[model samples]
Target: MSAGHTAVTTPQPRPVPVEEPVIRCETPQDECGVRDLLDRLGDKWSVYVLVELAAGVLRFKELQRRIPGPVSQRMLTLTVRRLERDGLVSRTVYPTVPPQVEYELTEMGHSMTHLVKALSDWSIAHRPAISDARRAYDEAHPA
Candidate 1:
């Protein structure tokens, strides 16, 4: 190359633009809504009841049977009532020789099933890792 001459190099191609997911910040109202929801559905029994009801309509006894652990009838009743109040479940009464009552998910409740199922799936998938972490923490902390 001549001392006064400079070689020209080709410019590199620009990177293709990729779309990023939109992120939303929760407002104060959103926080209140979340807190209210957590207050209503915070208990294990409520979550279990919702999960069972996600399948289909069920009678009180049937719901109890479907749940894995021991949940008292009174607790189940309360959970259902709370869910009903939250507009997450609907209760139907049929008049017969004896009155029959059934509980099923409302449209809003159905909408939440995917989220609940995803939570359950995540819990199941991470259970081993969580257990390992707990064990490690316990050992490290000696408590």
Candidate 2:
């Protein structure tokens, strides 16, 4: 080693400790309530309807148009009714020769917009991976 040369040693990084997530235990009633809410939110049409309304108030036909894919009028009607019953949506009727009805998200429903959007974004982002997984599973199962 030359007297003028000095060896340099870099410090190693410390490992970060990850804290485990806390799992909360629910009572029977709480479980039932959660199950019921999940069932409603998990419905095929409910999330679509909520997403559509999240933009702004939309008429029945407008909502039907905004939502991607095919959705029956009857099914949309039922879905809106269920959302209304859950206090997640509000329906307003305009006074006119022919009444025009509009659907919008309530305060409670608006509160869920962030969660629904996050789920939607996640689903869209993972769609390719999910499709690949499905294809692989189907190929293996041969069904």
Candidate 3:
């Protein structure tokens, strides 16, 4: 090469772009009964009942007392029936002089203890933020 001249290099070819297959993983509908199960769990009463059951079994009257104020007796009964139907809780009847009955968590219900505990932990951890939000919202709405 001459001192004053520069050599030009040819451009390299770009690699062909690979087209990856779009894998459609199974959705909730793909499972036989997952949608129904999710619907049951999504209920507020169901989660509350499960949380209450975590402490151990209780009679209907006891559950009525432990749950927050003003829950109707019919509502509690329905929640128990739903939980029992979903296989997450068990209802036991004691055939004594007065037929005592109790409700407790089944194996599946026991499994949900961690999830309930997590929700409780989160409520405690974010209490200040929740309080602030409530204050701001109430101030703006003036109810």
> Candidate 1 clashing pairs?
none
Collision pairs in model 2: none
List, residue by residue over 37-128, the lDDT tens digit for candidate 1. Answer: 67766787878888899889999899999999998889888889989998999999989767889999999988888878888899999999
The segments of candidate 2 whose C-alpha lies over 4 angstroms from its true place after superposition are 1-33
Taking every candidate in turn, the Cα RMSD to the unseen true structure, in Å, is 10.7, 11.7, 12.6
Candidate 3 error regions (>4 Å): 1-38, 96-98, 130-143
Model 3 agreement with the true structure over 80-131: per-residue lDDT tens digits: 9988987889999999978898999999889877866787899899999999
Best by lDDT, which number?
A: 2
Q: Write the per-residue lDDT of candidate 2 for residues 9-57, one digit (tens) a residue.
A: 4456778987864544465555635576687788889999988899899
Ranking by lDDT: 2, 1, 3
TM-score ranking, high to low = 1, 2, 3
lDDT: worst 10-residue window of model 3: 2-11
What TM-score should be assigned to candidate 2?
Answer: 0.70
lDDT of 1: 0.85
TM-scores for candidates 1 onward, in order: 0.73, 0.70, 0.61
TM-score winner, 1 or 3:
1
